[model samples]
Target: MTREFTTPPASAEPLAAPPSRTNRGLLICGALAGPVFVVTVAAQALTRDGFDLRRHPISLLTLGTLGWIQMSAFIVAGLLTAAYAIGLRRVLHPGPAGSWTPPLMGVFGLGLIVGGAFRPDPALGFPPGTPKGNADPMSWHGIVHAVAPPLAFAALVLACLVIVRRAVMLRQLGWATYSAATGVVALVLVAWPGQDGLSMRLAVAVTLAFAWTTMLAFRLLPPAG
Candidate 1:
């Protein structure tokens, strides 16, 4: 009897791997930008009175350099945010309840961050009241640097929560889910109203929450197999 040789059946498709730590790191890098930029803007706003570029001279230059670094960080962070969002879209697939939601929210958040970066404001102080008498756009510092940017940042956090909720309900609380939820809570705390001691407590809470999300993002990227 002649036996016909046949090709072996193809192996079943490989199972998907878990997210890798490296990817987690990248995602964290992207997500952290939101908090960092928010804090920077806050710092600038709080110190406006003391931060005069003309009188401080060298100090002014230093501050300017720091500002550039913060801006650069935001850009890098935006790219990373986009990248992770795309990854989630892949796993979650197309649907209102899938991965797309969180990431899209993230993109919007990034927009707020990036856009805020472009907003101009007065160097530090300029008449303790709101703008008046047709002020120069360049001199519109406080609003641009403080309020608008943080609002944008808050938008991202809100987006993250909406997306993450779906994931949590679905029992798929991965890095993306955690990051989104934690970010939202953090932003909210940061924005809560209070002065002195209360402000410090809120700030700490926000920072810690964001930091947790960041840590997960860096540690829990989906694995490639």
Candidate 2:
């Protein structure tokens, strides 16, 4: 008898595995973390008394009776970002990005958590009734908090560059350029000096950083097919 051959039905193709499904959910959390944190802080800045975005650092929101809101936002966003990094580590298997990006992302998340745990000292006339001058002889907690943003921002910047490295290896020049610019601009903004509108610069720098994170999450979230 002649051999008979049969093809499997279209619907019989294997579906996405469980870990992949979990990763999608986690990536979505990463994508949303930046927006949630920024929106929460922005809304508070607009409404809270003596909180001028042009003058005050966003961290100052973590002061006064309403400070708890910002602290919660920080911790929650950080946890979500950490989850995002974990998902990325599992799925970004094609390049060196898989090696470096996740750990840097984790560092950024941890920095945020630490920053939330220790609010920065009041300065530049924020929280109403506080002195317009800087917080001299700063509290131990405030000093610790001061270290978080720069460290977090630096980690995030490195993460951006790491993606660039992988993109270049894959010959994705446009993606590489975009990633490089994002990292460089954020670093420059954060490192810029001068008091005039320094607060606004910091705000913009952070927004750029967070926006990059959100967009990168979306870009990498497509499932393997």
Highest lDDT scorer: 2
Q: Candidate 2 residues 1-225, lDDT tens each?
A: 899996644322122223366877888888999998999988998999889998898899999999999999889999999998887787674446887888899999998898899999889888899999889989999998999878988999999999898777767778789889999998988888878888888888888888989988877665554
- Candidate 1 local lDDT, 1-225, one digit each (tens): 899994522321111234455544545554565466456645654565554323221112123434565455455555655665654444344444344455554654465455436644423333234342323544444344445445545655665566566545545557455667577566756666753354345445445544654553443344444
Poorest 10 consecutive residues of model 2 by lDDT? 10-19
For every candidate in turn, the CA RMSD to the true structure comes to 9.4, 5.4
Model 1 CA deviation exceeding 4 Å by range: 1-63, 99-103, 112-116, 119-148, 172-184, 195-209, 212-220
Candidate 2 is scored at a TM of 0.88
C-alpha TM-score for every candidate: 0.51, 0.88
